[model samples]
Target: MQAVILAGGKGKRLAPYTTILPKPLMPIDDMPILEIVLLQLKKHGFTNIVLAVGHLAGLIQAYCGDGSRWGLNITYSMENEPLGTAGPLSLIDGLEENFLVMNGDLLTNIDYSDLMKLHLEKNALATVSMYNKDVPISLGVLNLDDSGNIIDYIEKPTLTYKVSMGIYILNRKILDHIEKGKYLDFPVLIKQLIEENEKVVGYDFTGYWMDIGRHEDYSKVLEEFNSIRDELL
Candidate 1:
């Protein structure tokens, strides 16, 4: 199986650290985040991989060349400038069928093989790995009237939403939805697909999934890794 890693982002939210190194190259435990991702994909029999890199591309290229050390075949798809998540995908070549695609700065125990199986069974053009997120409103949110008067108030409302896990199983045909040489983000791509009457399935993975896009997520990784190292992986 082949995997595409969207590692082009500057990760501005993870600044200071990202200023010196690519977010994917940031050390997580004993190894870089990209290394962890490669290991996980390798474990699941995904030997062919692509690293879509932009900022600090040289560092990543120097670090993981041909992916031979991991017993995987790695290739590089360099973006001249930062291409949005789905945009750089258009630059990749030789993707036969459905393959794994994910953000580089994520740590998760999602059963990728199972996700692929479900994607095939559902015959979907795209399958999104999803996580359930609860964004709580700490203050009472009021529904304002036409004149800006409060009509109702809900206190400490915890809204549960199924959000994207920055991971996906995408069929190659979906590339048709992408405009060439443009910034095409995931949400806009998915929205367009839905509007065009395409099937996009969601593979719910509520298991240990941490998006190390921010400091808190990085902290959680260390905490979770300590207690459930074997299982958390």
Candidate 2:
């Protein structure tokens, strides 16, 4: 199978580190995070890979060149301007089949083969990998009525939600929804697909997943990557 990795974000939240290296090039146990992702995809039989790059694209290309070392064929899709996530896919050629698309900075042990299998089984136009996330509120949450009076109050509630894991299996047909040279994110595209009565499925994953887009997440992955290296690699 083919896979497209989005590696072009400016990574403003990662600041200084990203200033020199793209977020995907950031190290996790001496290996660039994107390298780890590539290795995992290779292990899962995804031999054709495309990196959609913009910020610091040269460095990523220089480092990953042809993906020969990883036993994969690598190509690049350059985005002259920042294309919000899914927008870059429109610029990639030869996507005439179902393929995988994921963020370059993600750290996860998700089973890509299984995800693709489910997508094919369901015949979905798009299959998003979903992760269960718990967001903790530090302050008390208040509920108010239209009269501005307090209706209910709760302290430090933990909200649970199913969020996109930034990994997806998309059918070539979905490319019809994308406009060339326009910035389009996954959420907006997914919403449009739903509005048009397209089939979009979600595969729930309760395994390790981290988007190392921020300093805190990057630090956390650095601290824990070693323990889970076997699972990922």
Candidate 3:
């Protein structure tokens, strides 16, 4: 199977640390987060990998040269300018009929093979890996009816939403919706697909997952890594 890791982001949210190293290169425990991602993909039987790189691309290329160390065939797709999220897919060549795409800064134990299996089983143009996230509201939320009448109130309630995990399985045909040399985020691309009545689906995952792009999340990973290291690696 083939996989494309989006490792090009400037990671402005991660400032000073990202000022020195790209988000994918940021260390987790013993190695960079991107290394862990590669290991997981390889374990799931994805040998052909393409790293869509920019923003300190040289460092990533040097550190992961050829991917021979991990018994994977790794290639690069350099972005001279920012390509948002899905735009970089246009820059990559020779993508398989269906391939996996994901952000490189994530730490998760998701089964990539299973994700692909679901995509194939459903014959979907795109499959988004989803996680149900519970967001707590500190203040009360109100429901209003027509004419601005307050209908119901829930005090400091929690809301659950199925959210994209920045991981996806996309068929080659889906690329037709994306234009080359343009900035297109994933959300806009998905919306366009829906507007066109393309077959897009979601794979719900209830496993351990975290995006360590913020300082607080990074700190949480540091605190919890040792406990979940076995599950992740």
**What are the candidates' C-alpha RMSDs?**
2.1, 1.6, 1.0
Clashing pairs in 2: none
| Candidate 1 residue spans exceeding 4 A from truth | 142-153
Lowest lDDT sum, 10 consecutive residues, model 1, at 224-233
Question: In what order do the candidates fall by TM-score, top score first?
Answer: 3, 2, 1
Q: Per-residue CA lDDT of candidate 3, range 1-233, in tens? A: 99999999999989999987999999988999999999999999999999999999999999999999999999999999999999999988899999999999999999999999999999999999999999999999999998999999999999999999999999999779899979999999999999999999999999999998899998998889999999987
lDDT (10s digit) by residue, model 1, range 97-177: 999999999888888888989999999999999899999989988899899998999998999999999999999999898
lDDT at 83, model 2: 86
Q: Candidate 2's residue-wise lDDT over 1-233, tens digit each?
A: 99999999999899988899899999898889999999999989899999999999999999999999889999999999998998999899998489999999999999999999999999999999998899999999999999999999999999999999999999999889999989999999999999999999999999999989878888899999889989999
Model 1, C-alpha of 43: deviation from truth (Å)? 1.3
Candidates in descending lDDT order: 3, 2, 1
Best by lDDT: 3
Residue 12 local lDDT, model 3: 91
